[model samples]
Target: MAAAGSVYEPLPRPCAFSPRSRDLLAISGVDGRIQVWDTRVAALRREYVPSAHLSATCTCLAWAPARGIQEAHQKKRRKSEAVDNDDPYDILTIGTATGDILLYSTVKGELQSKLVSHHRKVNCVRWHQDNGCLYSCSQDKHIVEWNTQTYKVKCKWKGDSVGVSSLCLSPDGKMLLSAGRTIKLWDLQTKEVTRQFTGHSTLVTSLMFMPIRAAADSRSPPETTGLYFLSGSIHDRLISVWQVRTEMKQKSAVLTFTLTASPVSIDLAPSDSKEEPMKLAVVCRDGQMHVFEHVLNGSHKKPLAPTCTVQIATSGGDGDSTPKPVSILSAGFCPDKQSMVLYYGSSMQPLFEKLVLKTDEPHMCLIRDVKKTLTLRKEMTVTKVKTPVVKAADTKVLMPGIPGHSATVTAMTVNSETQEGKRKPGDQEDTIEDRLGAMDIALPKPPTKTILPRADHFSVLLLQGLESCDSNILNKVFLINNETEIKRTVAKLPVHCVVPLVNEITKRLQGHPNGAMFMVRWVKAALVHHAPYLSALPDLGAQLGSLYQFLEMRVKAMQKLSRLNGKLYLLITQIGAFQMAQRTSMQSSKQAKLVYEEESSEDEEPNKEHNASDDNWEEEDEEAEEKEEESEKEEESEGSNEDSEEEMDVDKVNSDVDPGNESEEE
Candidate 1:
């Protein structure tokens, strides 16, 4: 099975097959030989030794479709009576390591033109469809345009200060984008620079421009096509999809995407007609090629997610003889063959793999909107799928029909139940293996994020904390005890993640008594205390505002039903307090009356006995009464003086504090 998908060479470049016919395949070897294979029998057709003839190593290659062959033949007949048209001819252009571009015909099996202009190695060569001009970039910091027909240098553009690592010509050929210190968009005719995109931290290694939607064949090319292009870097390990604005002045590079692993190369499987879908395949440094569904709404640049990833994992043998997996050097998708070809190096030979793409709608990648995604997930969904119930194992695998297929989750994971039975008691694998084993046998399982607790947990907390009715368990688990903690967590959440959480949070808060007041206070604190903090986080405060707004709207709707509901509740509370106060006052008055009655009764008996029995004693009693009155007055005066001191302290306190701090009730 591996032998069918794998072809062997010594250099890492996908074999260029004839664009017109799928019969011939071209492979360049490290031994400096280019071999043509007949795809019909999978056998060698012919060999050409370009290094022996030109004395230079081949760096890059491209196939140019022969144009007007019959017309050229008729013109040749006028120059000479004999015309040779039967032999198969290939207008192949190969960039060599020795500062030269070699143009040749495979049928004649000889070097046609040794096009030389660059002072350093030629990095890439491509023939633009619109201008019929072959463009080559080199370490010499120059892009030389050559005549595709005459094989002569037409013009040289020194656009970049540094050597151009990668370049892509727009389909219309009016604009050119080259990557060096930065990604630059250039005007072809006026030769003026426009926008410079510096998002990537490192030099961009690869770039390609593709249409967002496949245009109808009946419509003209440029007007009906899409404007988005993709770029990838080695150090950044990111793929950025940039779109050209409507004006085509090259001022704005609206970013459409940023994802993917360390990409070694990328290829687009564009649809030939509107009925088909567009697919983008990225070959990463890891021995995997990820496929994403590229979709858009009209001309708008939308979200991009990978639908699935496919990898070749058939490494065996040992020691120095064993070939470790190498980075994918190049990959190309040929719709005619319905296959994706990936090239990489191995021990003795370069590995050429032809993977069959499942063109059926079910397996094809799909695009989604920007704001749609689960809040609890850390990774974005690159591809969405419908996993059929597997009665045998209840596991999903890659498409069952793709050519040279094998299991991706590995045999160990596929039969983990049995493997677990063999393990020692209480033994556990390390974190990495434990995680890998836990993964489902699916292409991608969007991982749950650790930033916020589980959505279910959060929702439950919201319901319990916001309720006017209190439940202990719900209060502890769901309540945001510290506003600062809530702010910090919310600040880190992505906009897509924040919106859904806020919706559920606001929804719960809306059902509570005084929920609107609670939300208003919360929003006010966030905006006032943490305004600077929230400003650092994109769209965080806005999301919080959304929560407050939802609560406000719900509160307003309730208010419309009864304007005095809050006032009525307040009145009920006040009445309860007043009744309690009256009950306490009545009890105190009764106690004082009983005490007075006891004192008066005791004194009444003593007063009567003194008045009747002793005339001399009456004068003495009057003197004693005067003495008691004097003592009582002095005691009363001392108490009043203490009360006046307490009043003075209270007045000093009131004078010292801010007037607004002392809230007065009317």
Candidate 2:
């Protein structure tokens, strides 16, 4: 719907793409008009106003999968008992301001049922694909599950939030995510709140679950379940991706990273085949639909960066002329995955190549060949949807919830064939490079044909993000675990880019114990790998020269101080020279005594025979007696020494362990 000179406010939930046909788009309008359009051709297929919807506005719409006759045939073949499946959903479910749900059949082109669903405006309705259940929530602060076939209430429960604004369910129908006071992740089977994510600065406006886009990369661990989802906020203008791992003992959604965008609608673009990288389409307050191709870094598989972006023009208008910029309510990618012929990884990274179709041009062009920028234009058609402007006197104000206001999006949710419970990217923040990859710029992407950002741009963005991060995160760049990666990055970085980062690292590492070690290593790598590049940049070469001079001065000063200290030590040793000279004299006297003893022994050897008979016999007898006494004394002394040693050891241990012992301090 369009109004001239006035902003269009789309419903909290506006448009949905058909999962069955993959070509049909069902859009709910404020004028209670449900329009079906062919997504493939961008042509209006049909328009219908449900008689059951009495109100002026259709709040939300969801398309049920196309029901086939095969189910009935199988039932008959198996001889199973059954009643009529009245809810053959080749149909659409519409919620309106009158708290009523209108189920209209696309096949029959008529309303199937008008169920009075809630006490107030029906906020959202979702068709559970797996369990074949329909779920709806409202301002009544309750979520009700309806049996799709019977249109009967299966269950209803009061919610914790005063008004539940949005709802999303897991693909398996075993989990429910509700957003209002806060975002709550609930286990459907246990009927218990499993986790609550609290960082949304405002009311969570829209949310969708996506399997990790680049999860096919080899580094991602085998997962237990695919429970990753993205949530967007209004006041914060932030999008947060979360990973919830169950099946493991760990049970909470870990916030991976944040993107700053004034998002209106977000969805994934339909891929050509299962093996293709997931393409994400996000529509912000800006009218352009930005389609980013998800690519995993080859060095680190878990790191996800939109290496390429292809923006397409989509607005709210009929065919034949340019579409007008209407408030995008919501969008979804078609279920059909298109197949195409392609070649990659031959000097081209998946992150580096992107295909975009320009509005003026009929052909798709590789973004890499384009210049530095591209501008998006929003063109309106000749005819417009005339929505009446409400004057104060023309419409009654109900003043519901203090006369508040409302919130569009488009999405394609892909199912990852990878196993469940794969380790989430957020869990492996073991390196500074990972966090650097996580850091996002606050600046909106410039309109451009070259979606592939220069590596230098990435470096500048990383520097900016690091500049604003907390001290702990800032210090991560210098950490030992990341030093190797940091050096490798430094080796490849242009000198101009490295300058600011060097300052940042130096500032962060000032006075750090390992600062010198890392700096030495970093300098070594830079000099070795980047010498030629640095030499070419005159400014960079001069800066290196300055640092070299500073280091040389420090080294010279240190060497001089060491020499002076060694000379002072030698002077102090001169005081002990007198003791050294006395030891030398004692050594000479000992040598003379040794020579005399040798001469005496030689003379005694000959004299021993002559004296042997006389004095020698007497002396021998005396000597024998003396030897006996000495031996006896030696035996006694040895025994005493052992006893003394044992006693001393016991005393020493006591002293070592005693409470009052002074030696224990030493």
Candidate 3:
């Protein structure tokens, strides 16, 4: 077993490709910036700096589909060939920290409009793939549906206590699912929260609506044959397949299957072959990219486990046979059905590559040399260069996920009956000489100027202070490579340090203040609503109540301290007056006693006065005892005041956590 393992080393680190297989239009984060990448050449095309809400980070991005072809044709008739419908046109909408949703045009790269409706951070935004409607969920605990054409909010549905992390619209746009901890499904037409899914034990990270059949299938029935939704959660490490039950009056759903993986991202394959099962590409935090093939077996009446698996090689080393796991940050299906692209990053720059899958076995066939027959306008055109043609049998097996240009053949086959090359009626004799034998041919001359595709323009909002790099300078830098290399520039942004204030306080206090503490109160009221796990815990309500009480007590104590300070000022004033009066009275009494004693000694005799003092001394003893008790009570009050000062010190320390300053430095 050891020898066999040694022979099959782990996979190598995936090769990075600059020219991506698919278009990446928009990227955003909490640090108010939006980056756009050109898919063709892997370059940064353009940057947009929105003036409003520059401090808020962008959380979600969505694209709205273009209108019909007639409108596109009319626009193209005007000298706007660049604006023609050759490229996909869509409305790009982004959600930000300030709960504002900004919409822009992908064709013109212009900001179309903005919506300032949500009260808190907007977490997710989804545009109806088949309609002009938009759906957004925020930390405000509400999901709003909007008419993209009129820019009006059509309806709103309240979510659970916690903010939503992800949202998915059914393929037909009839239903919408907002998931955080509990998955809440809403009827879009009726604008009501219809059903709640409660199987996941943790926060749901991603939700996707996978079509049961290809979206282009005209024969698919709207009610039964369209799409089913799949939900993936971080805590549960499971992917739950859900389908709306038509038999039920309310269109309730049931979970079909749960996979054992924390799917951080998912993408469906774009194949229309009926025999080909739906493919789900899942990225788990365990540094593994799992490709699951959903098979609907007729006999079993349920979906089978993945039919085939492809483990991505992450680490770059000799262990190529035992595929090293990698944390796949994001993944998407390419427009071409042959490949899928995945994006990954660690502490270093983000890397991108394509994974091609083999759909057919190798076969020996003949490929005609079409280049020899066709001629370009220029005689020395690169497209007209004639290359030798080989019988497909001479070629080798092609593995999926390997680049077409450098693929190595694993196997080969040649037909003995077709060993003699025969020309067809249309085939020319001169062109036949170029086949089956190496011949000296003149190389094609290189063109004087290489024509490159026009750069796609996009806007990037720079974080505050990042503008010191001159929005123009930053734009120039990003646009250098058509925005494809923009991933390298992400390091220039200020690194964000995010720590829950309540968690920090809890750690500092080592479990003091119970639920009613000031820190606990802030978390329950302000942060819990934003947290993903708020709805998952059963004791959240009681915990929040205790936290509120702790906050109330702290507030009351602060108010009492203010009142006590005022009373202390009055006591100090009275003490000053008493001290002044006692000093004056002591001086007067001493002088009077001396005078009396001198007169007594002079007028009578010392012996008679001394005998009378015993009666006066007995009365003085009771007055001295009362004075001593009063001094003891005053000392106790002074000690209590000192204890209050120490408590104040603790309060100041607890309240001085500055998140903004700390994040800025980081």
Candidate 4:
């Protein structure tokens, strides 16, 4: 595994495979570092640090389409100079948490431009192949289009309230698809939403624009046929396919497919020939690859199921040298559509793997069972019988079909077992006699069924506690087990035990308010870990009803307490102000007394010869000291007045604070 400060970190977004070259890949790290990798050699080709600040986290990454760059340069005058430059024409764009879009030159290994417009983190970015324009959506609820040449916002529009989590551009560059809390298709030319898709239960995490085939054998390319797209969500684990056509008379219905895990990325592999079926590649959060075939044609009214599922497990000789499940960060089909590239593993130990798909018929077998079987008749008839010509002793022998003995002869039967046990003439003697003194051939047998204890010890303990209906035991069980252990225990619990556990939690919430928070945590963990089971159960409704009631009561109590706390705070502030005013008054009075004492000491000093001169000075000093004392007394009176007003305010606040009401309710 890589260390903390290593170059490799958990990828903020899956590595972006260059649309131009199959060998090039762009990966953005959580630490704002971007590295372009060459898939052919599995080595880093260039690294670009978009920002030197360590806090800048990368959120999204996209590669400028090769066709876009070519078309962009075709309009420029100095074509030879542009072609001769050392930097590759393809640009790698990376979005950061600071809402800055960085365009980096692949060959030069440096940033080309940093576009800043949005105030929140950028979620998705895409480059228009035909216009060389950049489209970006952010959490700021703004979808801005940028002119690549000027590096400025060309246009902007308001996105969804939940923020656009993903974006897809149509091939014609006239429409844009945005997915967030909902999926909406916008007319880029008109800058307005034309269609809105509903049915997703969670925020959409990914969007892909898939082109519809013009004909089964049409020579036109797949890129030109753009009228469909796919959207997926994290929590729902569903992929919905939608078709867009203004001429269609019927309302477009969404075809939804369920997935084992939430999809993180979706890519389309359009077949070049009719024999090859169109394939959809979906990479899930759990590092699983689900490939669905023949789903894009307009023939089906239902969602197409995945044809195959593949999981990439970590290899040995790494950290612990044990095979473990790797979480896939990103995955996509290669340009050839015959293989896939996968980025998986922990942020600290990120790894890359390539899977070569078997698309040809030779590698795939349709026959599931190849075993051959034979049938035989119950009876057989002999066509001819051969008779042995024996010597004079067999002259009186019966015919070949004659029976020699009765079928019910009472005698011991001897077959292969007896013949095999018989010792041969050349067999050697036994090596030694068997030891019957100490060792016996007959061994003691174990009990058929011993009572073994249950393996889920904590769950068993919790069940016992619930069965006994003891609050203390339940509380002890909860306190001893952490959240992870509790979740594991909940998963191990049988389906029947969940309802009782929930009921117990509800009881605890009602009877023991002090432990309500703990009980709530337990219930939340249980539900999160075993939601599929608990949701299907009908008995859970009653428990959840009581649970919600308790929550509502608690909420009301909290509101009351908050109001009381505010009133008490006001009282405290008022009392503090009063005490401060009194303290200031006391300090002022002490200073005035000290001044008076000093003046009296001067007056009592013995100065007979200079008494006449000192007498005049003493008179002036006494007059000034008397004025200061008068001013200090006035200040004391003002302070006392302020203090009295503050005391009244404090008393008024105290009158409003009613702890008795809260106690009674409790």
lDDT (tens digit, per residue) of candidate 2 on 318-378? 4525543323334445344322111111101111122232323322223221112111111
- Candidate 3: residue 199 Cα off by (Å): 0.5
- For every model shown, the clashing-pair count is 7, 27, 27, 1
Q: What is the TM-score of each predicted model, taking all chains together?
A: 0.45, 0.43, 0.47, 0.50
What would the per-residue lDDT of candidate 4 be over residues 45-72, giving only the tens digit for each residue?
5665422421255677888876354324
Local distance difference test scores for all models? 0.57, 0.53, 0.53, 0.64
lDDT of 2 at 579: 76
lDDT of 3 by residue, 1-666 (tens): 011122111111211121223565455421223455554443444344433323244556665554511122243334553543365544567776567898765455556678878977777787776766788998778888887666778887677787777888886778888886588777877777777767665557678776655446566565564446778765455567765554643232344433445555567763354456776766555545556655532223344454334444433334444434444556677766557775654312334456675434221121222223122212532221122234454543221222111222222345674576775679656655666344566678998999763333222333321324243543343233323233333323232201222323333233544423333333333353334433332223322433434455568789999999999999999999999999999988778554333333465664566566777876667877888999899989989998999899877775576656666778
Worst lDDT run of 10 residues, candidate 2, spans 341-350
Q: In angstroms, how far off is 249's CA in candidate 1?
A: 8.1
Q: How do the residues 1-666 of candidate 1 rate in per-residue lDDT, one tens digit apiece?
A: 021222111123434555544455566664446666554443454566432334455666777655512222333233221232343445677776557787766544556677879867676777777556788888679988887566678888896887687778887778888887688888877767777777765557678887645455555555455577778875465577776765654433454433445575677866655555667777665545667764533433454555666644324333444333334455567656367765544311334556677634333322221122222222533221212122334333322222221122211324656667676779776697667778645566567964755655544453443332344543353355566655554554433233344444454465676544444433444355445544433223223543644555667788676767778888999999999999999988878554333345777887798777785886787899999999999999999999999999999888678576555531
Relative to the unseen true structure, what is the C-alpha lDDT of residue 377 in candidate 3, on a scale of 0 to 100?
15
lDDT of 3 at 462: 31
Instruction: Name the runs in model 2 displaced over 4 angstroms.
Output: 1-13, 50-52, 68-89, 212-226, 247-261, 269-277, 293-666
Top candidate by lDDT: 4
Most TM-score-accurate candidate: 4
